[model samples]
Target: MTTSNFHGAVGTKAKPVTSQFQFGPWTLTAVKSHILESEGIARQRFEGELELPQVPEMIFADNVLRLQHVAGFGLEFNALDALKLVDAHNDPLKVAVAQAWKEARADCEHINEVVKPFDWTFTTEYKGTLIGKDGVQLKVEPTDERIDLEKLKVREKIHFYEDILLFDDELSDNGSSIMNVKIRVMPTSFFILLRQFMRVDNVVVRVLDTRLYHEAEKDFILREHSYKESKVQDIQGPPHIVTDPNQVAQLLPIKRETFEKLIFPSSSISQKEADAIR
Candidate 1:
């Protein structure tokens, strides 16, 4: 994806916000915060970061077998962000940032919520498929609707780590950054697929080229050519599938509910709103 510079949002200052995130077995520190300014107006904003542990060789190997392949935002709101938004008196930029923060938290909640973890068996029934060429998909009825596999932009890549003999989901070195606006917005869009595949905690399943969508019915399908395929030679049999999350963590450190929280951040709802919900 290409990023285009936009006007109207001239950045005046950008400093890292102090924040930290704890995911499963790892701890991440806050990098920085920035105060964005436009039209002679400025508001403090926390630049988002994805902090997770480096994947262990074992986990990396596990992911290679199947295919390769955030936080720090609490105290702010509990202290003043909520009241600040209301106090901003509807200043467009301030209100926008406040709402955006809330939305981000909501994203965290949606991903890590308990609705599914306790009953992951329901994920096996999802029929949706994330269509990233030879990437991965859901083989059964979907447990959650947060991610729409069919909606993902299908991009191609070369298999770098394993041989064509090993048929697992091929990781894309597409070089897309998580902070990429599109990904930041729907942070969980990709993981909902993983969550659907994960049956146990601290683990996520990654499969590619296993379920082929056809004129028939429920089965995961992923087919990617290591190289171009001649019309006459429809080489088959390398389509692989692996059910584990270690590989995924190397790329993005997220375990089931934590992952849910990572994407649908609880910050989406403020202490006031949460109190209201309660």
Candidate 2:
């Protein structure tokens, strides 16, 4: 694991710190910044055109994972991009939450106040932002490739590891919503998991995961996205599990899944140019 650090400026005028590691042909970087301020939140709300979650101030807008290959292919995971996936259309989940809130606060004087509709649960299915080098066209094609769990289970020396929290909220104490990304590098391969977990009290529990895996010296990477969810009442577990997204995620049933492969070019040439040369 090759490690390095750098500093930059962000909101609150605080210096943002970055940590990175270099492996076979890839560079993995994690950037962490202070929580968003009122000014920052207002700007983001306007720019993103979305109603954010409670405690939006906790969001680390600059926190991100940047994984790049020497060939200029890369992927980025960040809070702003993930929050954009929250329901803009009045989905069932949003409606249900609104109704629940109204019913729970029927006696309150402000119960009838008009409120904008958004995915109160803050669920998102974001995988990652794919990046290609200048003049290169990179696309992830559906493939049969899958990550080898058995191999990952084996004990091996870990070269580098990082867990980055992008954003999190308590859903105004109705439940919780959190998004984070974790990565681990080993001698022969690396794995990344970008996850979004949400729980709406007496409503539902959901988890969306995007996994990326690559072996040393490999010319391609494997990517998988899985979504799982279960009704709050239907989820039978210890009392504590309901509050822990990681624990509840194990009990939720899989609702959808997909796999894809990203192939790297042999040289700096674009795929179209390479084909022409061939």
Give lDDT per model, in order: 0.21, 0.75
What tens-digit string does per-residue lDDT give for candidate 1 at 30-86?
222321221121212211111111100111111111111111221110101111212
Pick by lDDT: which candidate is best? 2
Query: Model 2, range 87-170, lDDT digits (tens) per residue?
Result: 754445754565765565455433355355456566788998887668553467999878998988899998888889988877
Model 2: how far residue 183 lies from native, Å? 0.5
> What is the TM-score (0 to 1) of candidate 2?
0.82
Clash number for each model: 40, 0
lDDT for 100 in candidate 1 is 35
Off by over 4 Å in 2: 6-13, 40-57, 94-116, 266-278
Error (Å) of candidate 1 at residue 26 is 18
Error of 1 at 65 (Å): 21
Prediction 1 TM-score vs. true: 0.16
The global Cα lDDT (0 to 1) of model 1 is 0.21
